[model samples]
Target: MQFKWNYEPPTPERQKAAKELGEKIGMSPILANLLIQRGIKTESAAKRFFRPMLNELIDPFLMNDMDVAVDRLNDAMGRKERIMIYGDYDVDGCTAVALVYKFLQQFYSNIEYYIPDRYDEGYGVSRKGIDYAKETGVKLIIILDCGIKAIDEIAYAKSLDIDFIICDHHVPDEEMPPAVAILNPKRPDSTYPFHHLSGCGVGFKFMQAFAKNNGIPFARLIPLLDLCAVSIASDIVPVTGENRTLAFHGLKQLNQSPSVGLKAIIDICGLTNRELTMSDIVFKIGPRINASGRMQNGKEAVELLVEKDFRRALVEAGMINEYNEQRKDVDKQMTEEANSIVEKLESQKHLSSIVLYDENWKKGVIGIVASRLTEIYFRPTIVLTMSDGMATGSARSVAGFDIYDAIKSCRDLLENFGGHTYAAGLSLKAENIKEFICRFQAYVNNHIMPEQTQPILDIEEVIDFKDITKKMQADLKKFAPHGPCNPKPLFCTRNVYDYGTSKVVGRHQEHIKLELVDSRSSNVMNGIAFGQSAAARYIKSKRSFDIVYTIEENAYKRGEVQLQIEDIMPDTQKKNEK
Candidate 1:
């Protein structure tokens, strides 16, 4: 739990130039320093980070199968064929289904959606789902968020005379499934400029190509941003560049101006038709949308997201809220169990990765356990739910490791696997699970660093009391909507004081909220550190420590312009270290 600050001091000239340019641009010296550290020295490069435009988005046709996928969807509509928009059950998957279903609905009346049951059928495109596609007499199946790993299933659908167009963002196998059109940037033949589109982003581009071909104004489709942005945030994709543009516009689209379905969710969160921010969506709305699949069926989220009636939307939101509540309960228990297992395992000996499976673990929440373990262990973690002679669940990894590719390396043992770098889903036979873990360990051992085996908070710079300003906050907002690749700036200030004489907060008293001030200068700021109530003891003693926090517009007071703390490290930043 300890991190050493290896501050990479800026060259004197570089610091001088950054400070001078920051003054010219009305930016804080701290922000200018952080920008320079991010290699964003040029005005043009920096400007694009903040004010990204839809025009900057790459052409939809740049994708390898965009034209073919568009043509096939159009063909299905022209022929009046029954088409099923297939998708996964997560926020990304469900929203992709919603995005594609809505786009096709404008032209094709036969468009319906099918999402697999998380417990019974598990993640990705399911054979049962495909069978449903076949039984519905679906002439065409356009898969969103899934199908990249469905080599066998896609072939089976093809055998049934059902054509498929896959819009996915998961890493591909050496040999792809024989779908009619494969629209994943990771595909070898793909020319898409960016390879890291969220599943919904890929689905969005598929719709864009369809729009361009069918003479449909994609402008009409802009409303889908609320859907896409929620997915982008929940799925944890980088919000830099194109993704940022989507989320920026999408967050804007969500404020009081949401669709009837989203309005219901907003109301359920006790914010009645008010302006919403990324925080509102991520902390409040996105969790409710994701809870359905994590605890029950992810398709419920899609139903709520696309509903047009306020009454129905409320019903859906209420259902989601209830599910999210139960999900948190289950998640809390599973996280504790996973943490205990990790503690027991690590106490015996060190390992490059953490892999655990249990027959009794709930399939719906195994991914949650994996994510939690990764946060605690700060390494690659996989949690599997064993049932029916097979284990299924999720993998979450750290920065330097690619969990999907690591799983792919042991594909012989896995019946199927799919996902991106940091997150993935898979199913492996119970007997092969042991061998799979060994190989997975080897895979990670070769790629990871000795240092990365332990979690390290990479601090860019430590700011003094005189380093922050409102303009710095605005400058950092330019790189938004920051996510996976471009993250919100993490600033650290050493030896800070609180104005409100801090107190433990949150439902569990596991958090600390206070107004921080420089004891000498009277420069005041506010912060909240979740799960850091232990630090309150230090605050009570008037201890000045290195604190790492992201600037947040605290909505705790309904409408406060004060900054909130994200994470704190009382001992992380030392004077001699700086």
Candidate 2:
């Protein structure tokens, strides 16, 4: 894939401020510069960034309708009313349901949890779920990770004498759902200081409010942070401000004393001794948890999460792992089929978007397939499959593209759609699929710039090999629990040569293993570029090159830092100059 390297240049004033702050704090200027670039310009800001505390979380009551939600919950508990916790099927929703249901189970026994089947019930606030609540004599229903736009569904439930308290983080419509209480930070009337809480984060805030109102110490809720962290990471929310604080502490909990289900999963993945990071959850744990819902039932995931017995949790985790294996098989086959279709479409190669459809494609893996297609085609892509009588699928956008808005432009054809800017889900009449595709392509062609179709390597700074010292590596560790907003810093080094012993490694010989030496100081560093064996030709040519990479402690060798290469290009300009 081709990439555009966009190097960030800190202004002179900002550089001077960072240097002064570094001197005041007795740290490296480069570390200070990185902090300032992330909006931490003062000693106080830097301290908070480095040491995020649980107390720093915003007051839960500050969220709009939080008080009402707490009051409804208190009433339910006092009356011993039957209440159902309803949630979506993804990781965020499953975790949210688990966290709230477990926390409430301590003080109440009339509660039950419900997760709508992805294929049968589709997305949020399903008619089947509402009917279940109504038939079971449930008086209150708490919706998590969804229901923000469930106006009609909420009204239908209300007619059946079932009140609702909604906890969600997705963008809301102009007219809010007529629920008893709606808690969302993105609501226009919200007074909450943070606006980027995941669906599980919103659910966590509600739990906090319930605990505080009942005179329970906030420490009692600390154990639930592991679930919150998993949700935040899997949901792909920005890791800044409150999220960073939550993830920072949550990871500590996950490493030190994970819940029974999480520990079982860790054992299954053979990560018992390793310290867990956000990346681990995103790849290993998150997918396994989500697989249960995708392949069979989300209730299995919730059951595993709230299970208190280690042996029982292990059994559940094993079943979920098998589901994950099934998910992987389906995902791989779907991706291969999608690739074959893309390859045969020679005429559609030059278009600004990719929209492919198949009646036999598994609806569960279309989202994952859409994401993988972007890596090969590198554009706004959508993968559609026949679900029910309609065409349903997922859309994945390249960086900086608003795929949700693009889908909204063709809403005339779509029966329903909802999601964030980078990703979304939609469905349309099966017959309208052709028209929707043409309109979607036209929308992309008109609005998407030519450069937006290509991938981008955002380099934070250009640095010398000598500057990558032990102290620098230590300073960088403070920026842990990295994600969307506060990402691991990427640095570019120009005019570097392969240190003669470099070669392609990995079982398939698809990884580049090299020792890079600086042109000026001749300082040497080991680098690994995973799946970049294509660059072997450039390395074998022995040409000076520029490489972009992030620094990481090499686990194979203690007390050593290595470069995890992001991109590499031959330094043709420098070669010409020589």
Candidate 3:
């Protein structure tokens, strides 16, 4: 896929500030500029950004309804009331359920977790789940990740004498549910300092409040940051402010001493030796946890997460691994079919958005397919499939688009819908599929920016080979747990030529392994351009080309840094000069 390289050089004033800050901090100006771009203008802010502290976390009681939620929770445990920890079936939801259930189960005995079946109960607070709670004598249900929209279900649970304390992070409507307390940073009246916590993060805060109220040591909560890190990375939330602190510590916990379940998964993924990063969770561990929900029951994921026995957890992790493999197969097939359908669309090129429907498509993997389509076509996309006599599917948006609003615009046609700015889920009558498609596309057309329709590679900074030093790479490590708000820096280095050893090296010969040297320095840097073998001929011709990439430590050579090239283009500046 072609990309538009987006690099807005900092203004003179900002550059001066960055220079001054760099000199003050004894680092390169480029590193300081990246910090400034992320709104870290002062030394204190940069220090906090680099060295996130647990003590710096916001007071949990500062959140709206915290007092009520904590009081209700404490009362339930005080009376030994049977409490149910319920959650959605996604990663954020499963991790939230596991985290809460694990923590509370330590001190409270009358607690169990519930994950509604993706097929039988669908997403969020199902009537069946409420009935189960009623039958099981559950007096309080702490629903996580997805209760903000379950007004009717919460009422039903209430009628059965069950109270709800909801911990969610999704955008909420003005008319809130009838829960005993709702803890969501995105609530209309929320004054929580950080608004971007993951659903699990919200759950964590609830637990934090509970711990603080009970005078429990904060050290006990540190173990659960592994789950928070997973949810924060998997849910694709912004990693700034509170999130950064949680994820940074969570990653440390994961690498040093993970919970038994995550340790099992880490071993299964063959990543037990190396230090795990947020990227590892997003790519490896998160998928395995999510696969259980997609292919089977999400409860299995929670069960494994809260399991104490390593042997049992390993067996569960192995099963989850199989589920992940199955999910991948189904996801790949659905994505290919979706791509074929999109290719056949008569108005494919001109349309501002994409909505594809097929009754035969697997509902389990439609979200993955929709995400694949958005990445491939670079447009807001929704892939729907027939489920429970209704057309149900997931929607994915481009970098800056609010897909939730676009889906909300077609709510009349949709039987149910809820999600965030870049992703959502919806179901509608089969007959309304065509109208929903037209309406959703129209809304996107009316609101989407022209640039949002295209794939754009944001180049964070421009640097020469000389700037790619050991010190810079080490300092870059300070930017751990990168995500939405604080993304891994992307660098562009221009006019670099291959040093005679670039060659195709992938299993299908689809990648270029390069030994590169720029004119500014004689240092030969090792780089890998994945799936860019088509550019091998030009690169081999000794023609200088410009590249945009991220630097990472070479897995093969532990101490060496390698450029993971994103894109390579001919040297336009040098073309006229030569």
lDDT of 1 by residue, 102-171 (tens): 7778766887888888778876767898888888889998888888878888888888899989988877
What is the lDDT, from 0 to 100, of the residue 474 in candidate 3? Answer: 91
List residue ranges in candidate 3 displaced over 4 A.
Answer: 572-578
Per-residue alpha-carbon lDDT of model 3 for 414-523, expressed as tens digits? 78889999999999999999898888888888898999887888998999999999999999998887999888899999999999998999889999999999999999
The predictions' CA RMSDs to the true structure, in order, are 2.7, 1.7, 1.5
Task: Give one digit per residue, the lDDT tens place, for model 2 in 1-578.
Answer: 76778876888987898889999777888888888889888898889889999987899999999999999999988998999999989999999999999898988999999999988988899888999999999999999999988899999999999999999988777789999999999898879999999898999999999999999889888999999899989998999988998899889999999999899999988788887889899999999999988899999999999999999999999999999999999999999999998889996887999999999998888999999998888899999999888899899998778998899999889888888888889999998999999999999999998778888888888889999999899889889998998889999998889889899999999999989898878688999999999988888788888999999988778779999998888876446546
TM-score of 1: 0.92
> How well does model 3 score by local distance difference test?
0.92
Indicate which candidate wins on TM-score. 3
Clashes of each: 5, 0, 0
TM-score of each: 0.92, 0.97, 0.98
Model 3 earns a TM-score of 0.98
| Ordered list by TM-score, greatest first | 3, 2, 1
The models' CA-based lDDT, in order, is 0.79, 0.91, 0.92
Superposed Cα RMSD, model 3: 1.5
lDDT of 2: 0.91
Model 3, C-alpha of 235: deviation from truth (Å) = 0.1
Question: Model 1, residue 360: what's the lDDT?
Answer: 85
Better of 2 and 3 by lDDT: 3
